[model samples]
Target: MTSRANRSRNNRCATALLVATTLVLAACKAQAPTPQPEPATPQVTADTSAQPARSTDAPLPSEDASLAPAVTTPALPSAFVDKVWKVSKSGAVEPGTTYVFLADGTLVIDSPNGTPMHGRWSFDKGALVMVEEGISYPTEIIAIDDSQFHIRSHNPGEPVDIELVPAPDQPLPKP
Candidate 1:
């Protein structure tokens, strides 16, 4: 009789413990998770009108214009102005190459071979044109943001997607 009493008590304790654990788990599962807010996206619009032809001798806008509180110039996006961009991938140009678009229409390219090439750059119809030695090479800006840009070369061949990233090491040209 004593042994039977002890066995009954142990069974009851085990059942109680199992019930408590199940109730605790159920309470945890009943609680709702907090909702997360969606990320805000920047608004961007495209201009389809024809732009006036810019002369190679004509200088670009000042750097202050890009940083101004209001939008004044429509020639180039503010993100592209006064930025040192590095070619992440390209067929014609080698990777790890750096390019700087100055506020004075000067395009400086530092190749991996340590050769620095100087050219004139301009933005027309969502495309960036770089002219060197009277030869014009235009690249279409597929997408651009504050940090990076995607460009497609107009050269006839295997169309390679070129990604340009902000080069913090390369400083922007003085205004």
Candidate 2:
């Protein structure tokens, strides 16, 4: 009788120890960090100045630029203002229209049909606003580089999104 009781007690102790070890192992595994995949490196192309343009499928006025406080002299990107940009796709401006952003904050738009349109452009806090004639266009610069200048104009009735590419070297417009 005594031997049988001793054997039963020993078996229960061993089973309890096994259960505790398994629980601890499970808890540790739950807390372990998972391995993450490494990021792929960017490929270099012949035209290093060019980058893929963003999709303009979405409607304009993604963000309100009017709420942004006015700036005295908005700092425009040197690369964007340096070259003339030709419009490829737009809702407001005609296709093939050329744009020149001067260092003195002059925005010149040369439409194929009419005379050059003069406007004042400013960029501050990622908000670009252009004033021409008597209308204000709050513009969002989607992307700008040496090769491309894409923007979305927040015109009240019909918001215009435009894609522009670097045009051939041309003479700077008169101030």
Candidate 3:
């Protein structure tokens, strides 16, 4: 009777050991080596939703860069790069918002999806203003640059400053 009980106990111990070994093996297989990224390339397309592509034509992260500076102001219209900019923490762009600008002093921004906000943009004598449609007052453009801008209203409220940055997979400037 003693021998029979000892044999049953040994069987249970062996089964527990087997289960533990199996669990250890599974854990080892769960971890995998991470893959490395390839070399950087150049020549990316213009996209506002994503960052610029990795390319040789693009500037490196260590390169000296500035979004906007006090000096070296650029002229409007010609300097503005027409693209779909993501409105971060700004007022609604309205439904079906389509921004169209012509070189001949004609500008239109319409909302196609929701209520439309109509406004005409014009720059003169180093001043910028948007008026008409539903806006109560004119919106003044304080300053604009490659990656940042400042806009203020005539009524003396907090000036809204925005930074325009390249989206991921965006087109990089030609080197």
Candidate 4:
């Protein structure tokens, strides 16, 4: 009887230790720094009508690195990238949602449901384009300041505007 009681206590101690170790590992992973992604190559289309047709034997334009045009991606506003934004008003996204725009074009969104969504973002012709789950959302920056941001999404058939303010930073959960 005493041996059985000892085994039961030992099993509980082992289970608690395993759970604690798992929580500690999860916290460390959550705090790990994200790796920066490689820059994307810009797509350039040449006008074939202006130049004479070439035979199959001819070298492709990509064969000569000098011929490639220099294209630079416009940088996102410093105010937008510098802070975590929380949704104060929006018809599309729920209020209290948070957003973090990393300089490496990574967009992190946390909704009220506690699920975090990841997406890619880029700038085109002074407009913001966010790609999530393979769908692109072209957005316009209506206004932005140190403490506030406003944007209008031009999703075909479903246009909406959003207002955001700086959100207080939330610390990672501890074990």
Whole-model Cα lDDT of every candidate shown, in order? 0.70, 0.73, 0.47, 0.71
Which is the better candidate, 2 or 4, if ranked by TM-score?
2
Ranking by TM-score: 2, 4, 1, 3
lDDT of 3 at 89: 31
- Tens digit of per-residue lDDT, candidate 4, span 53-158: 2477856669977744221123245757736888999988899988777777887888988778888777754568877767888876666766677777777797
* Candidate 3 local lDDT, 12-128, one digit each (tens): 989999999999888888666788898889888843221212466766546736522332333455555344333333443332234443344344444445543345566665455
Measured by TM-score, the strongest candidate is 2
Where's the lowest-lDDT run of ten residues in candidate 1?
66-75
Per-residue CA lDDT of model 1 for 1-175, tens digit only, reads 9999999999999999999999999888866778888897887875633232345574555643653322222336566767889998776778888878787888888887887888887876555787665567776665566667666656556655778888888776543
Q: Write the per-residue lDDT of candidate 2 for residues 1-175, one digit (tens) a residue.
A: 9999999999999999999999998887766577888898897665311222334673433465553322112324675774688998876678888888888988898988989999888766646778888687887666665667777777888778899988876667886
As for candidate 1, its clashing pairs are none
Clashing pairs in 4: none
**What's model 2's TM-score?**
0.55
Give, for candidate 4, the lowest lDDT window spanning 10 residues.
67-76
RMSD of 1: 16.2
